[model samples]
Target: MVKVKNLTDKEYLYGHKACPGCGLGTIGRLALKILGERTIVALPASCMSTVTTQYPQMNYSVPSLTMAFAGTGAVLTGMSAGLKAQGITDVHVLGLAGDGGTADIGLQALSGAVERGDDFIYICYDNEAYMNTGVQRSSLTPIGANTTNSPSGTASYGEKKPKKNLFEIMIAHRIPYAATASSAYPYDFMNKMEKAKSIRGPRFIHIMCPCPTGWGFASDLTVEIGKLAVETGMWYLAEYENGKVRMNVISKTLKPVEEYLIKQRRFRHLTEDTIKLIREHRDSEWRIIRERWVLSKC
Candidate 1:
């Protein structure tokens, strides 16, 4: 476990322009706090890159690289190889990308890198939509959430498709270490990051980072909304290692899907029937999880 008192006072990521309560910024700061100074951060053309890499006021204290939208994984691979060529093994190569970059266009590059078993850490901070570019929809966007590309009105409901199961996809590649995390659970996220750093080859961590701007929630509600996501079964926390999966946090009884859905404007347009469908879907998914994953006491 990562003790709060033992955490360093130094800020590795700061002086940025992220939203007031941006979960992406919070997760980035926490991740680097765990990874420490010996880390090379890489991000694609996403919210983190846009906010942190602005001219005249850089945010990242550590070495950071901004790559093309579809090249984060590829860049990490090269960074790892370059470090190995120079016989430098202590530094960690970390890649941070948003949902669109990870689950959509960048999937091929990421899959290729993982197949080669490169030594690097890839963290996908999923905000569920293309929040960096006009609130467009991505593969990871949940059903009934309104995006600019998937507007909801009298003519249409919000997004009809379900969110992509990214964790399972990473497991399919047989990654040595992969975990699902939420910004609301910072300590758990930190512990997972520390573990990934300890032993790593194509490690991946999928973090559900709620976007207040895109999700149509008040900035102050970012953390509260994140917690609600897990409480309502819209998101989950788990880890995969050694060909096995384990649940990290399990709720004996889930809060109603409406409790989470009503807070976000994206889901405001959802009718009772649609919400019912979503609840049913969540229940079905949880059933699969209960059957397949090793339930942890935590």
Candidate 2:
């Protein structure tokens, strides 16, 4: 068994409200481990909100503000501003949400937060669909993937659009730091989290989390499925700073995209043509990201 490194944070102890194998919960547990007691969390309505704010009590070790489904960035920005006005700069503020909360409904507040260079580390744990709300398709959902709203049948080509390019959107804001990570690898994920907080301006972290409930995979396969996402180039590990692109993993020998697809029942309806189409789209997108965009150290 892989032993995850320990964290100094001691807030999380016994009781918590995450479903068994809830990837988001693991992410929160790990993140707060580094963010520690000195941090405050601003969360939008998502799986995290549900888990942390489970009816009888809550799970956040530090102070937290639960904002509307799409207002985490705005709320966090305002909170940070209020704290700044009060000369409370020692506490680190973090705004976090799901992919639906980040890529779609919450984009406006998120964009504004980044553009204004709010002093917070905003994270989106991208489960790709709105899992807490009946597994509907979100802008972050992969093309050709079936969601409750995009089920395969006589209608539509199954989420007709590509996954929204959130990284590009963050880049457009010229934010100080932004990176994409995977939950299956905590070392890389936590390292990025720590690094992002060190910067003075806004920082964005987009983490891919596998959802067994929504993705139609067995819960036990969460880690393996997440790993397959990277091995197949379906999801990649990338980072950006000072306006340049740096990809962390581009497998020398890519695991077939088909292996990754067949694991999830969501893509089970695929015919050979649909599979080919999906791979073609995936590669085309990868081609653009494969280039190393230079950054100015200024």
- TM-score for all predictions? 0.98, 0.93
Relative to the true structure, how large is the alpha-carbon lDDT of every model? 0.93, 0.82
The most accurate candidate by lDDT is 1
Clashing pairs in 1: none
| Residue-wise C-alpha lDDT for candidate 1, range 1-298, written one tens digit per residue | 8998989999999888988888988899999999999999998999989999998777999999998999988999999999999999999999999999999999999999999999999999999999888899999999999999999999878898899999999999999999999998899899999999998689999999999999999999999999999988899999999999998765778899999999999999899999998998999999999899898755
Best by TM-score: 1
Clashes of each: 0, 0
lDDT of candidate 2?
A: 0.82
Worst 10 residues of 2 by lDDT: 289-298
Clashing pairs in 2: none
lDDT of 2 by residue, 82-162 (tens): 889999988888886999999988999988887887898888999999988889999999987888899887665577677
lDDT, residue 70, candidate 2: 86
Regions more than 4 Å wrong, model 2: 1-6, 292-298
